[model samples]
Target: MSKTTITANGQTKNLSLEPRRLLADVLREDFRLSGVHIGCAHGACGACTVHVDGVPRLSCLTFAVQCDGAEINTVESLGGDDAHHLLQRAFREEHGLQCGYCTPGFLMTMAPYVEEMAAQDRMPEDAEIRHAMSGNICRCTGYQSIVAAVRLAITQRRNGESTQ
Candidate 1:
């Protein structure tokens, strides 16, 4: 077994895994982070999306051993009484989800992108937002609400408002 240490959510997780164990399996099976779903089990579907070192990655395509010393964030981390990420709130306000299976991926992927845009003092243009989110495919809500959620997040961030 290969041992790896990864910080997930706000906690550190040490895992002993088989060489071929996917990161999604480790997060869900071993660590009990079921929010990182496995959809395609390939890199195509964003259902296994999570943040690694503040960037979105497809956990299904990533091996657990490869995540040694990495910082990972899953959708579960966003839950709490005071937890109010803009995307999460915007999702609710804008009704951005249907069926809800793909919502986690969309939220996790867009969180960093919107935060980056806010840091740069620019909101992503519609085309830019679409292009940036091209990898995530949602079969529900027709994506209009998803786009609205991102826009709302950008607006709130610019206004110095915290969803929490």
Candidate 2:
């Protein structure tokens, strides 16, 4: 077993795990962060997307040991039932999810793009939104609602509305 330290959901943890253990497994099985879903396990699906050091990564393709000393943020870190992030609220308001299996990954993957666009004080075009969201796949909703949700979040952020 290897010892590694990771800050997940704003909480730091030192864990002993197999060197080859996947970050998805560590987050889900070890830490009980069930929002990190493992769908394709091969990283093609992006179902296990998470933020590692403020950048989106495929948790299924990453080793826990590789993330040592990194700050990780899963969907759980975004918000809770009482207070929802703008993206989450937009997703709900726009009906971005159907089965909801892919919502967390989609949220994780699109968050940085939304934040960057907000900082730039611009909303992405439809084509740009599609390009940015190409990594994540959703079997339901046909992506229109997801794109709308992202656009809504970007608009909210640009308007200086609360996003967290």
Off by over 4 Å in 2: 81-83
lDDT string, candidate 2, 1-164, tens digits: 98899889888899998998999999998888999999999978888999999999999999999999999999998876443989999999999999999989999999889999999999889999999999898999999999999999999999999878
Each model's TM-score? 0.93, 0.96
Question: Residue 53 of candidate 2: its Cα lDDT?
Answer: 94
Give the range where candidate 2 is weakest over 10 consecutive residues by summed lDDT: 76-85
Task: Report each candidate's C-alpha RMSD, comma-separated, in the order given.
Answer: 1.6, 1.1
Q: What C-alpha lDDT, on a 0 to 100 scale, does residue 80 get in candidate 1?
A: 47
Which residue pairs in candidate 2 collide?
Answer: none
* Candidate 1, 1-164: lDDT as tens digits: 99899888878877787989998998888778888888899888698899888889999989989999999899887654333777798998999998888888888888888788888879778888888788888898888888998999998988888645
